[model samples]
Target: MPTPNKPDFQPVLIVAGPTASGKSALALDMANTFDGVVINADSMQVYKELRVLSARPDDGELARAPHRLYGVLSGAEACSAGKWREMAMAEIAECHAKGKLPIITGGTGMYLNALTAGIAPIPDVPMRIRETVTAELAEMGHVAFFDKLKRDDPETAAKLDGNNTQRMIRAAEVFAHTGRGLASWHNEPVLTPPENMFFKKLCYMPPRDILYDRCNRRFDLMIAQGALDEVRDLIALNLPPTAPVMKAVGVRELSSYLSGTTDLETARDLSQRETRRYAKRQLTWFRHQMTDKEIIDTQYSESLADKLRHDINQFLLTTPK
Candidate 1:
């Protein structure tokens, strides 16, 4: 393809990896080093109610550098990848205007892909259609709703798990309102980023054993940091079970404990296991979907940051080819 018009093109740096891979720390280091603004790309981190479970940057870390788009949404509102992309693009422009680099960081592959590769032009389903589909799914439950989705949009259903309540409802709403399967809409050309924006991607891929250990230890630390209280507050919101925040990795397991369905120890173990599984999936997605990025196969540390300085400096100074 012909090179995109180079004049005024802005460069963005991306720090992506699985949970507990230290991508956040790396982003903070980069922000302090490069006079950059760190923009949130993690879906959960955007919700105001999920700070503890989402492992969102704490006040001290936030004080180290400018951060944007973190904890900006209510858990009651769902944030789609396209929605996040819009918000992220605006933040990037703001950073560039202020003569600061934009450092995007997160483990949400879908959100990152939306920013880098763009997203399909899937129209928003009407509120009426969405409400109706959501109610129907709640009444029928996931298994039945998934079966209905299979009949209505088999291509989409085949790719989704029955337990992925939010996506299933989304698929149903799209099919009901548009008279076309969600999969078909995906086949349409995606709405990509402007040619004037370029991304320098970096992914962390810590060894599986170390990554899983970190996932387990992090949950323990979260509990110590009053994650149970966070879950309690979230439950008080009475958000629908399918609400995106409600489905965060620790929410369900911890909620089970609070509801007397499981003991604390069991909940803790299960939550840690789920966290590990989530990390594994994230690693797989980054490995496959972000193949053209620089890879760091070890955990982040001060030495790693020192080693990365030269490469990041080059990315900041050079124009995209």
Candidate 2:
């Protein structure tokens, strides 16, 4: 196959969609065609312990293409959007230097937003503040920890989901370190990609019912493939309960089963429900957050690669100089 010509100024191809939408397959096909490197954008896929649950590429897939940043972190290390962006930028630069396409594919809206739009430069939290917050969260639990965050940074707290303990703790830590709210940081000037960089965005927006069905079936497949064992090992590590990995879609549901709190059937049903809900949120985010970009709403087919190539060509042709 003839390699596609690289666009001037770091070129990036973003393939985004809800979970189980075949984004990875599309990315792999494109990479093979264009001498591209597949870089992960899924937050959960970054953890080494989540290989099965996070749906990281299998060994055969990884062998076929150059993949980066998948399963690179231990469960103990939380990967924030900022950290992921920094790592992605480095990988994209490496691909550019080698005259290869950097194809970033995942369902993580925040990570993609950080790459395409930019991110506010939130000040780093002091180690003391981080440690203090971690200790406090452990002692207080989520309810108490959240109450404290509401008191310290109510605006940020209000914006966050009630059960998003990781973010709530982060907000509290920021306030402890800088005496400033995370919401206020949003008003600061953001650091975005350079002016010359060109981004081609492709999103999959499969129908709701079909997407939900896929999610449910995939969860069943996951359990059959020893996802329970993966969760068992994660629980065995006894990482902090507030660790981001603990809240991963299947972990809690499966943990409940393993702990004798629920039956296997109930656990599977609950996990599927959560996965469907997550897919709904992802669709909403893509609809609103990426309104200007092209969305593929139909069923995926073998011609997807050709269709994508044509769409990308159109995007490039219409891009302002």
Measured with C-alpha atoms, the lDDT of residue 248 in candidate 2 is 95
For TM-score, the strongest prediction is 1
**Could you give candidate 2's per-residue lDDT for residues 75-97 as a string of tens digits?**
88778788899999999999987
Backbone clashes, candidate 2: 0
Taking the tens digit of each residue's C-alpha lDDT, what string does model 1 give over 129-195? 6768989987998888899999989999999988887788889999998989999999999989878
lDDT of 2: 0.86
Candidate 2 regions exceeding 4 Å error are 1-8, 123-131, 134-168, 178-184, 313-320
RMSD of each: 4.0, 3.5
The local lDDT score (0 to 100) that residue 157 gets in candidate 2 is: 90
Name the regions of candidate 1 deviating beyond 4 angstroms.
1-7, 124-131, 137-168, 177-184
